[model samples]
Target: MSSPWFGSQRSQSMTEFALVAPILLLMLFGIIDFGRLLYIYGTLVEAANEGARVSIKASSPLPSNSDVENAAKNGAQSLYLANPCPNGPLPPTSGAGAQNPPGDQGWIFITEPNPPTTVETSPTYDAPGGQSPASATGSCSAINPFQSGTYPLQVTVRYNYLFFTPLLEQLAPSIILQAYATDYTEY
Candidate 1:
């Protein structure tokens, strides 16, 4: 005399769980990945700013491309600059402290824009433009920074980030993060 609904509740509940579990897991992972992305981006931007700040100084010993590059890399090194892919070593940092990358350094670049030309050469003597010498390119270098006049110094950084969530892999291999900063030289 048992009804057809003797134990249907248990089976129905299991089916519902099976369907909802994946969705919930995906949502959790997405949130984690997005937060990681923002943190990494902020770090990169700060690094670039630090590099530009150092390069804009017009001192006896000017900064070089490598010097700027080092600054940028060092600033962001405390974080996972590259993909920590599964099985990777310990994270760049465990807590809220800074540490160097467990693996190789991420790709960093610093460019030097051509400074303004004070002298003009042509069939006749003429000024290139009314722009002052300080009107140099925004790029900066330890070798030569903006001198004597107020000019803009720019720093750029790029990073390849790996997602810990496998779901990201299906969408794309790796995400690209970039940072740039521009500061005026001390006149």
Candidate 2:
């Protein structure tokens, strides 16, 4: 024979679980959304790097704009889903917005003359504790002229990531994930 307190223990446990379930579910959704965000960001970064790599290859003829764009598309082929965010904002073409210009893949931007200054970049071009790489006087010369030394090439990929959770959408909407890769020609 159990006391009244023990008799109601199962109900108490049920009540506690009912109170905590929503919060726990919310946390679980948040973790999943965070993981998705990271995956998208990593994909964008690799796509941009692939575009830059295509542009800077030591091959005789330089890669055309379309070629680089194709490389980027191939790099991010996993994200070729049917509109991840149909209701969300579209990527901006210029200005303080997304800065994603029109490309074969729609979100890749290429700059062959100088590295982009809009986003934070790692100092991969410079030696440890050494001076940053500077643009030379004839850096932007035509390929026919074939200027000496290394020339900078930058590729950028912008993606509008929509949260899978409805709570996240109400709180912050979509996040614009931008990635940039800069490389120099092997001369």
Candidate 3:
């Protein structure tokens, strides 16, 4: 003459936990992995911004793209708990004759608007009100304003992120992170 459900209640609870434990563990790991990914993205963005700021300030008398890239790398290293490249700086140049002075290469192209030029061969057709022949219908010329003017700086950082956690690595391949920043020269 005992209670009908008393003896079975504990077994029911145990069975429930056994059924749900794996799902709960999976969800926890998934959350951790997502958080790690977000952290990596934030680090990359900050690094790019720092590099762009350094480049725009003209920290180097003649700042090159390589200089900007290095700045970004330094920023990333500062943020990363475990750096991907442990040895030294990566080579900035593209191919043969790539290695030179630290800042020999990696110059970024700066384009400028060209000046206007008068067309010589066009006929001077008068407007309805006869408005000085429309300034001779000049054509625009191409000019390199950056030759003497301060130009905007852009920095790009490319990183291959390898996952060390076996759980995440098996699920997802290596990640690629690209960061970029652009700003006008300080001066």
Candidate 4:
């Protein structure tokens, strides 16, 4: 004769597994999504740092806006695979220049915190927290050099991060991650 417990054990185990499976899967996917978010954010920060480093070097000819931008792009090639989303966040303040890059790839903004002694020729990309200079257009551009004083060179990188998990999408349909690197310009 089959024991009562033995006869029902298989069904009970299956029921328990069925009840716990969704939660476990959800947790597992949640972890994966979180990891991806961290990785992308870290990459963005590293890219900004790299661009700032390139900008700070005392080269015979200062690195052009493109050069610094290239360094940043190279630093985070993995981001290209990510599905591009619309630009995230407006410039710091309403008046501040729009920080979002024109292209889906992203953009690098090189700005001097302290106004340069000479008038900037490249068309100011950002106002003192206002819309990008009317003269400046495109994703990246080199700001004019400062005559004196150790002013900080700020490199800001913006990228829209797309979440893989549906739940994350519900919570955050569009997420833009920004990273900044500041280094004193080499005189």
Model 2 C-alpha lDDT versus the unseen true structure? 0.58
- Model 4 Cα lDDT, one tens digit per residue, 1-187: 6686576677889999999999998888889988987888899899878977877776656565566667778888766522121011124411345333332345556665432322333633221121123332233232344533455766677776666778867887656677878887664
Q: Rank the candidates by TM-score, best first.
A: 4, 2, 1, 3
Residue lDDT tens for model 3, 123-174: 2211111112222222311211122235554444445555555677787656
Model 3 lDDT, full chain set: 0.44
Cα displacement (Å) at residue 103, model 2: 17
Poorest lDDT segment (10 consecutive residues) of candidate 1 = 122-131
Q: What's each prediction's TM-score?
A: 0.61, 0.66, 0.52, 0.70
lDDT (0-100) at residue 129 of candidate 1? 15
RMSD (Cα, Å) for all candidates, in order, is: 12.7, 10.0, 16.2, 6.9
Q: On a 0 to 100 scale, what is the lDDT of residue 160 in model 2?
A: 66
lDDT of 1 by residue, 1-187 (tens): 5478576677879999999999999999989988988988899988878877765666555554555666766778685443221111112222443233322234444333322212211111010112122222222111222345666655656566777789876786666666767766554
Candidate 2 lDDT for residue 121: 30
Residue 132 lDDT in model 1? 20
The 10-residue segment with the lowest total lDDT in model 2: 123-132
Q: Which of the two, 1 or 2, has more TM-score?
A: 2
Assess the local accuracy of residue 115 in candidate 1 as a C-alpha lDDT between 0 and 100.
21
| Model 2 stretches astray by more than 4 angstroms | 3-7, 81-106, 112-149
**Model 2 Cα shift for residue 31 (angstroms):** 0.2
